[model samples]
Structure formats: structure tokens, C-alpha cells
Target: MKKFLAAAVFSCFSLSLFANSFSEEMLNIYAKLSVRFVLMSTLKDELSESVNICIGSKAEDERAATTLIDLMHEHYPAGIGEYKIYVIKSDYSNINFCKEASLFFVLSIEDIDLPKVITFAQENKILTMSYDQVLVEDGIDISLFIGREIRPYISLANIFAKDIYLDNVLLRVSKIYKKQEE
Candidate 1:
């Protein structure tokens, strides 16, 4: 009861932030859904006792990253499930700061800096989620496919490369992302 109420309130607050733009609205929706999908991962048990989520960004996206962390703290005061949530703000240059993270939510970053982050995440077996769906094709573990009904967009090859596994239920409903061959 209380849980449902809290989620409803949070959803309203989240959606309100990007109500002016359809694409921004989809991003907000995807951000919220990302939280739920974390629990559905088969590797959830391997996460730290206090799950560390790194909001990876460049200098330009610092404000957006901070806003996201603040919102997360406000809405998830009790953390999610039995795992305590710890949001860390990280810059692209200092990707090492996120080595302890279980999940890395990459904000809009330069193309050159992206591969470094992706490599780090893959090597650490940390789940990589992106704010932009286009990044999914670039080796991000997850994003949302904004269509008539939004759905999760996942890169199976990338996740597999990272030795990360999601539950079948999530995979069933997601749109598998395939990298384009040159």
C-alpha cells in the first residue's frame, strides 16, 4: 500500500520534469523503468550489499546527473528492496570513480570518451544503461525503445560480453539491439 503510493507519487514527479518534450518524457519514463529492471537481472544477487549506481557524465552534463541523483535520493529514501542505493556522480575523465559501481548510467558523452567507459563497464561486469537509445547500438547494455508502447532496448551481445545476465522475463519483453556492421 505505502509502496504503491510512493511509486505513484514518484512517477508523477518524474514525468512532470519533462512534460514539455515528448522525447524527454520518454527518457524520464525509461529512467524510472530502469530502476525496476535492475531487480529483474539474474546478476542482482552479485551486486554489492549497498548497490552503487554511478551517473556517468562529462562536465556539460553534470547538472543533469546531479538532478537525477537528487531525485533518486528523494524518491527512494528506503532504497530498493533489500539493497541500499548509493548514487555516485562521475565524470567521463574520472571513470575510475565508478569501478565500485554495480550499474553505470551513462549520460550524453562524447563519442571518443564512450568506448573507454564501455570497456570499463564490460571489464567490471557492471551493467551499462544509457540515457539515449542510440547509445544502445554502441554497446550499452540497455535503453528504451520509444514506440507506440515504450519497451526496453537491450544489447544481448554487449551484456554477454560483460558477463552480465538478465532474467528471461525481461529479455522476453525487450527489443534486442543488434550492432550495425560497417
Candidate 2:
């Protein structure tokens, strides 16, 4: 019984460490993406006073949104009036707001109509990002993942399809994906 108890405690400690590492990675990704948006906007001559980020998530995923918001605030303190993060329910009515956003991070596409969201983003020049590779494959602009290392998978097709212009420096660092020639 003592041995079992000790093993359980060790397992819990290991799990917590893994969770902390994941959280830290997520925070770093968000910070990098925020900076990328600012730089992209500047390159496009659309530099604004504040970068608007619209987070789309279902009601059940509110906790994830809250965590991301907290990280964003921590990384970008109030004194820096450079970015604003807004959490919005994934709904048709909020499409306009999403279109106006500088960047849209979809927390979960399960409850949302992803094609519609993508179409709106493409039409409005809003960059879309997700942690899901499936979404990236479906033409989302960027996907943040950790496979031995943290990196971004960028879709060149999606980027060029949009009206916005991304700097070549950003392009060179990312893993660019282009559609196969049929």
C-alpha cells in the first residue's frame, strides 16, 4: 500500500510538470503570433493603434479562452496598448466581428462551421490560426505545434489567397505548404 501511494504521488507530479510545460509553450506561441500580426500589419501598411484578436470557441471551451486571455494579458501588459484579445462565440451573427479582427484563433472547430469561418476570413484578409493540424490542412493560415520542438506550419496557398501581405522573413522561418499541382 505504501509503494502504491508513493507511485501515485510521483505520477501526479509528472503530470503537473507536463501540464506546466504545455501551458508555457502555448503562452510562447501566442506571444509570437501577436508579434507576427503586428509586423504583418505594418508591412501591409495597415498598422493600427491596437491589434484586434478574435478568439472563437464554443461555450464549453470557455475555460480555454479564459486561459489564453490570461496568458495574453501576462505577456502583453496593459501599458502596451498594442493588442486587444476578444473572446467570441462561434456563431454566424459574429461573422462581421471576426472579419474585422486582425487575427482569429479558433480554439475548437467542432461546434463551429469551419468552412464558413474560413471563407469569411479569406474574404476579409483576417489570418486564421489553430493548434489542430486538420484545420491547417483545411487551409487555415497557421498551425502551432510541438513535435520535438515548437514551430509553425504555414500554408502559402492560404496566405496568398488572402488580401494581406506577410513579410518574407516570416515566410522563410515557417514550414510553408502549397497545394499540389493537379
Candidate 3:
């Protein structure tokens, strides 16, 4: 109907106003900001003096993960707040490696069972984020989109189910993803 058409057009227009491109610099900035939104209580016991991040990708490819790590180190040489940033590349085969991380960030990956990663993160209370917004639709907790400005695309339901809550400030600025009811 006319309402549906109007809504769709408005949605597209709103997206147009925001940045839709990807850059490692912007992604690193937003990714760091994303962690700041996690309540201290949620991470108090899980993290010590460091904020561990697992950069996950396919077994054969680690280019994106490496680039992200490089960018993170270059940008945040002193780390974020009181916690130092510790990053490791994960192929998702060694669950123990990822278990030590507070955040699991999905890179460019294919042919891997991603739901299993989500399940693992939920069980472990780890925040799951992705480089691709499309993965947010697939249930990754958060992804950043940038063109004119930085915007976080998030799955609140997914993060909430894992008992991972983001600050209201982030929720206010983010584009939350909701699955279409079938």
C-alpha cells in the first residue's frame, strides 16, 4: 500500500544520509567505541586489565584480520581507557583461543558455520561483531557503516540473549536490526 511504499522510500533515504562505505580507520574507531558501551559490570569479571579481541576469519585467509590489528595498534597505541588492547587472529578451530577473548570480531569469511560462533559467544558472554553489515542480519551483534558519518548496525536481540548489553548512548546513535516476522 501507500504506507509501505512511503516507509520503504524513507528508509532508503535515511540510509543515504549516513556513511555506507568501509574503511579500516573508521572501523577501528567505531570498534573501540563499541567496547566502551559495554557496561563495566558485564566485563569486570570477564576481563582483567586488558580487553582481549579475537579477529576471526576463514582458515585460509587472514588478510582482513591482520589489517584490522595493524590499524588498531596504530590508532590506539596507548589503548582505550584503562585497559590495554590485546588482539589475536582466530580461525575458530581452536575454541580455547577465542574463549580467552572478550570480543569476537568476524572478518571476511566464507564456508564457515557462523551460528556456531554465535552460540559459543552467547555461552561465553562474548560480544560478537562483524565487518559486514549483512552479517548483522545473520545475527552478528554489531557492524559499522560509514560514508558521511559512522553508524553502527546492531542486533540488540542477539547481544541481549548473550547477556551482553550496550550503553543507551550507543543504542541511540545506532541502527538496530530487527528480523522481519515470518
Candidate 4:
């Protein structure tokens, strides 16, 4: 009985550690994606001097949003004076507010009308990014996928539709998908 109880406790502890590690890995990926998006956007459009990132998510994903926000601020401090981060709640009215943002990060789709949001983003020429691979298939511009390692999955149709251009280096590394033929 004592051995069984000890093993159960150890199993729970191991699971907890694995979850934390995975969360940290995700956070790192998000931060890297944010920086790459900002840099690439700046390079694509010389006229744009600053990058504005809107982090959109449902209420339940507030912790994830906060983690990304903190990581971004740490990497690109306010002293840099070239980028801004905004937290946007899942609200229809907030759509207008996020239109001005250069890039939109969809942290969570639950409780949010993703299709509606994507439509608004497309109409406004905002680059949509997410960690969800399914969103990429559903027309989101950029998605991070982790298989053997973290990799970026991009939709060429969505990218061109938004008039967003990525450099050849990024294009080479990313797995690009196109719309299906009729």
C-alpha cells in the first residue's frame, strides 16, 4: 500500500513538471513568433516604422496572454521605442480597435467567433497568427506546429490575399499550404 501511494504521488509530480515544461516551451515559441512577425512586417513595408501587435484571446486564456505579453516586453523593452503590444478581449466591438494593429495573435478560439475575426482581419489586411495548427488549415496566415521540433506552418493563399510578403528565408523554412483546386 505504501509503495502504491508513493508511486501515485510520483506520477502526479511528474505530470505536473511535464505540463509546466510544455507551457514554457509554448511561451518561448510565441515570443519568437511575435518577434519574427514584427521584423518581417517591418522589412516588407519600409513605410511602417513601428509594429503594433494585438494579442486576442478568450477570458480563459488570460494566463497564456499574460505570459506572452511578459515575454515580449522582456525581449523588446519599451526603451526600444519601435513596437507596441495590446491585449484584446474576445469582443465583437473590439474588432474595430484591433484593425489598426499590424499583426493579430489569436491565442484562443474558444468563446470567440474565429471566422468573423478572420474576416475582419482579412478585410483590414491584418496578418493573423496563431499557435493552433487547425487555424492554419482554416485560413489563418501563420501557425506554429511542434512535431520533432517547433516549426512554422504558413498558408500561401492567405498570405497573398492579405498582401503580406514573407522573405525567401522564412518561405523556405515554413511549410506552405495553398487553397484546394475547384
Candidate 5:
């Protein structure tokens, strides 16, 4: 709990401001990072068909959720041309939400049951990610702000991809999780 608060405090600068206005600059960063991961982690030599990816409602009306959907949906083909990506909106619950996501984003701790979220993600072979303070404390993958930009990082130490492989192009985007003492 303490760790999460510290992380949230450090990252609050990027998230605390909510103008209800979407920033293209922010979206661009997300798009690039996501493209890097998708391309790198893809398990194929040739491009696969459309895959169903899920994003959670991290905010009321899910502003961040929509932003992610737009990023994945818009960038995949434009950036990789041969492959297609699909973003599924999560219902934010154990049963439906967890089931819907192949890649799940943690929006906020307040909106989730951490243990359940983690368990469901692992059991379902879903990749869990978050920008939430608490989930990060619990060692979930997260995207964080450095200066004005936030980037994706992960806790895949316990999570592994099988026949699926992550390529250098995507791994370049993932900064391995290293605990920083506050």
C-alpha cells in the first residue's frame, strides 16, 4: 500500500490533470509505444490476422480506455500494415471484464479488486498492465511518466509467454521492472 502511494505520488503529475480534452501528444506517445510492443511480442514470422485486445475503464466514462482503444485500433495497420488489432472495452468486473481482455490495462486501484484482477489475468493467459499506483506496488506491469512522457514497463518475471515470443522491436519498448527504493 505504501509503495503504491509513493508511485502514484510520483506519477500524479501526468494523470492528476483531467481537462476532459484528449491530447494528441499523449495519444501519439501511447500509439508508438503500443506499436513497438505489438510488433515485438508477436508470435509469428508472418503477420497474423486480427487479435482481440481489451482495455479497461480506468476513468469515469473510461476516457483513458477510449484513448487506448483509439491508439491500438488506429495504429496497428497503419504502423504494421500486414497485421490487424482489435481493442475490446472491459466491463470492469471479474467475470466479464477479465474474460474480455487478452491485454488488460489497470486504470485505477479504486475501481478494481487487485487479487482477483491479477488472478484472472494469469489464469486466462491475459497480460495485465496498469498506470495505477496500487497495482504497480503489487508488481503488475505499468506505464509511467518520465518528464512529460509515460512509457510501458512490465512485471513479466512471473508471467511468461509460451509458443508466443516477444521480438526486439517490442521488447525495446518494455523496460523490465526494477524496484526503486523511495
Candidate 6:
């Protein structure tokens, strides 16, 4: 009951933030679904720590991240009180820790100044996601890149297979690549 109440409040708060970020159309679409372009759609009625994007620029990742959280809140209004969405700007260092985050989205892959964020993601058990191909080659779990239809596709072959809980919302992946092998 306490957790439910918490989810109710946080969900509302997050929705308010969403209303400020995305367009009304997007808000409406998100309202009807969990809208996971990755693996977030699988889990239900339970809390999951979302992807923590390491952004090099607030201009790029912040809006998207906020919009996603807000959508989550709106979709699960009464049962999603809190979301673990922690963001950190990239320092372009050689390496970093991402294992703690449920999913790690690298917005500034170039700013990180590393040959492989994928190696790091794999080393620590963090499921990596990126919008770039070179980064995907490094072993990111999902690629949330805007392609053919403007919506991103999920790269199942790239994701690290592990014993982690993923939301069902993510499984309904947008089909960006028509014939890509799974």
C-alpha cells in the first residue's frame, strides 16, 4: 500500500514533467502505452531502474530522458511512484562505471573519448544502448537510433545476455531494419 501510494504520487509528478517536455501528440501516444523502444516494456506492476544516460550535452539527452520518464509515469499513473533515472554528463574519460544502472544510454559517445564503451558496459553487466553504429559494434545491448520510420529499432544480437529483468514495453521493438537478423 505504501509503495502503491508512492508510485501514485511520483507517477503524477513525472507526468507533469512530461507535459512540459514533449508535444501534445506524443503525450497522447505515450499515455496509451509504456512506449519502450527497448526492453522496458516487459516488466509490469514492478519497479525497474531505467537507463541512465551519460550525456555530454544537456541539449541532446536530457529532453529525451525526461520525456521517457514522464511517459512511464503517465502510463502507470497509480503504480509507478518512483523511477531510478540517474544522469551524469560525460567527461570523455577513458573509462567509467555503468553496471549500477539497469540500462546505460550513451548520448555522447564521442565525448567519452574511449575506443569501447561496449567493453566497459560488458565488463560491468550494464546493458548498453546507443544511437551510433561504431558504438554498437563495441557491444551495446540495444540501439535506439532513429532510422527508416524515424523510430529506433532494438538490436537483440548486440545486447548482453544476462539475468536481469527487462520490461515488456521494450519487446514491442520498432522495426527500423526490415531484414536484420535477430
Q: Residues 13-107, candidate 6: write the lDDT tens digits.
A: 43344313333333334323322422353222233644344432134445554554555556655433354444444534523644444455554
Tens-place lDDT digits, model 3, residues 24-48 = 4545664555455443326645667
Clashes of each: 0, 0, 3, 0, 2, 15
TM-score for each prediction? 0.81, 0.73, 0.76, 0.76, 0.64, 0.48
The alpha-carbon deviation from the true structure for residue 178 of candidate 1, after best TM-score superposition, in angstroms, is 2.1
Q: List the global CA lDDT of all models.
A: 0.74, 0.62, 0.70, 0.67, 0.54, 0.44
Rank by lDDT, descending? 1, 3, 4, 2, 5, 6
Per-residue CA lDDT of candidate 2, range 1-182, in tens?
Answer: 66555534433442233222124445446655754554564323564565567776655555566567666767666624454444343444476876657777776666347887788888777888875655887778877644444456778678777756677777666676666672
Provide the global lDDT of candidate 6 against the true structure. Answer: 0.44
Best by TM-score: 1
Q: Residue-wise lDDT of candidate 5 within 106-177, one digit each (tens)?
A: 644453466777677667665566644346557555454433334556555534632245655545755556
- Stretches of candidate 5 exceeding 4 Å from the true structure: 1-24, 42-48, 58-61, 77-79, 94-101, 145-151, 161-165, 168-174, 179-182
How far in Å is the alpha carbon of 162 misplaced in model 2?
1.0
Cα RMSD to the true fold for all candidates: 6.3, 7.3, 7.2, 7.3, 6.6, 10.9
Winner by lDDT: 1
Consecutive 10-residue window with the lowest summed lDDT within model 1? 15-24
The weakest ten consecutive residues by lDDT in model 5 span 13-22
Candidate 1 per-residue C-alpha lDDT over 15-35 given as tens digits, one digit per residue, 9 for 90 to 100:
343322123344456456656
Report the number of backbone clashes for model 6.
Answer: 15
